[model samples]
Target: MKLSPTYRMPLKRRREGKTNYKKRLALLKSGKPRLVVRKSLRYIRAQIVEFDPKGDKTIVGVLSKELKKYGWNYSFKNLPAAYLTGLLVGKKALERGIKEAVLDIGLHRATKGAKVFVVAKGAIDAGLKVPLGEGILPSEERIRGEHIANYLEKFKNIKEDFEKIKQKILGEMNG
Candidate 1:
């Protein structure tokens, strides 16, 4: 007779592949609040969360949909929208007295210049102290949607709105 392998029921999330315990452990060990960025095919969301024994508490949350109020009329999953969403989150975090945070892209692969870093760049621009390597962020032109200028005949029109929304976010952050 053979014994079955031991199972740790408490970590059901890890066992079922819902959470990555190792990565979560590392982030928690840092003892800094996590700027968790999660993206769906249609939207992106970021939250500043503090680890707690009872349960992680979210200090601030920002969603791409909020851009609609800032005069953004474009795809929420695009680069510009991602940046704006991050900026929104960062500004809120700063308002709530959160000066710094560690990026937590849970279960997401680290691809250079991906949406994750784009969000980080936005947060940094909003004056949040999120530590990130300069090399990891997408180019400023891309973040500003200028890279598509070459092929998009509609770029001129959409680019104007992009600048407008970016400025709106900055103005809001300052005011």
Candidate 2:
């Protein structure tokens, strides 16, 4: 018995679990830039990306580490840092005249109040119009870093630091 040799291979990205073509297609169909938020164990990054035939162009990219420029002195991967990064990206996007975008979390699960959503909340606060469902963002206390502050003695002032950094980001962007 001879077996057929007409097997088709899947896309490389799919095999590598990187890109979800179906999701990408849906997002592209909306005709809006994508606010892509991704997180690693030690960092969070957000980008305003526009789809292109050749490749995706990142209009604005912000990393949690960039928060240091705004006076953030805590963990870069924390919830507050994610929010600040989002704010920075949103401001940058607005400066480039991108008024609206859609959230693209990629293959990450849509966990309620996750750091990714915190980033989205921050972007929303920064005047970028990214459509997000209600109740997906974290609570005010969490976003303010009160929870982290209360969790450790050394982090007692995290909430205050968060506010100061947040103000600095907004002020610089507005000015």
Candidate 3:
């Protein structure tokens, strides 16, 4: 260990590259539940969480892997799966009486039409009042997996799969 008075000790998570204290502070100050969205190489996950002095409490959570239960046959890490996972999380949050939330994208870059925003879009459509910019979110058609479906046209079997899944997601959101 480098023992020097000039050396400042960083927090454990900060050293581990897991937590961003600055961003977390800002989200906590919003006084709204946070819609935490995360994605891996193979799956996406979304959670509606509340801040607690002791620890963050998850109110509702959904994973793209859960899409299999709804008959999703595509990769769980795709854009459509991210949207559906967000929709599922939003529906559950609403059922728990959570009407609004601020998005917590963590260390992810905020790119235009990123998967995080797609999840936010799904949550918005599910009736959660999360603030979003028109320019950042993907188009309505894209959220319905049109972009994906178009790209998979040659593979007839899976070409329409996402559209069907989007319909099922919408149906679940409605009833």
Best by lDDT: 2
Query: How well does candidate 1 score on lDDT at residue 166?
Result: 80
**lDDT of predicted model 1:** 0.88
| Worst 10-residue lDDT window, candidate 1 | 149-158
- For all predicted structures, in order, the TM-scores are 0.91, 0.95, 0.89
Count of clashing residue pairs in every prediction: 0, 0, 0
lDDT of the candidates, in the order given: 0.88, 0.90, 0.85
lDDT for residue 154 in candidate 2, whole number 0-100: 98
Cα-lDDT of candidate 3: 0.85
Error (Å) of candidate 3 at residue 102 is 0.4
lDDT (Cα, tens digit) per residue for candidate 1, span 54-163: 99999999889999998887789888888989898988999999999999998889998899889988999899999999988888888888776655776656677888
Ranked by TM-score, the better of candidates 2 and 3 is 2
Encode model 3's per-residue lDDT on 1-175: one tens digit a residue.
9577887799999999999999999999999999999989898989999999999999999989999998887778777778888888888888899999999999999998899998998888788999999899877766666666677765344536766766777787677
Q: List candidate 2 segments past 4 Å from native.
A: 1-6
Better of 1 and 2 by lDDT: 2
Better of 1 and 3 by lDDT: 1
How much does candidate 3 score in TM-score?
A: 0.89
Instruction: Indicate which candidate wins on TM-score.
Output: 2
For candidate 2, the 10 contiguous residues with the lowest summed lDDT are 1-10
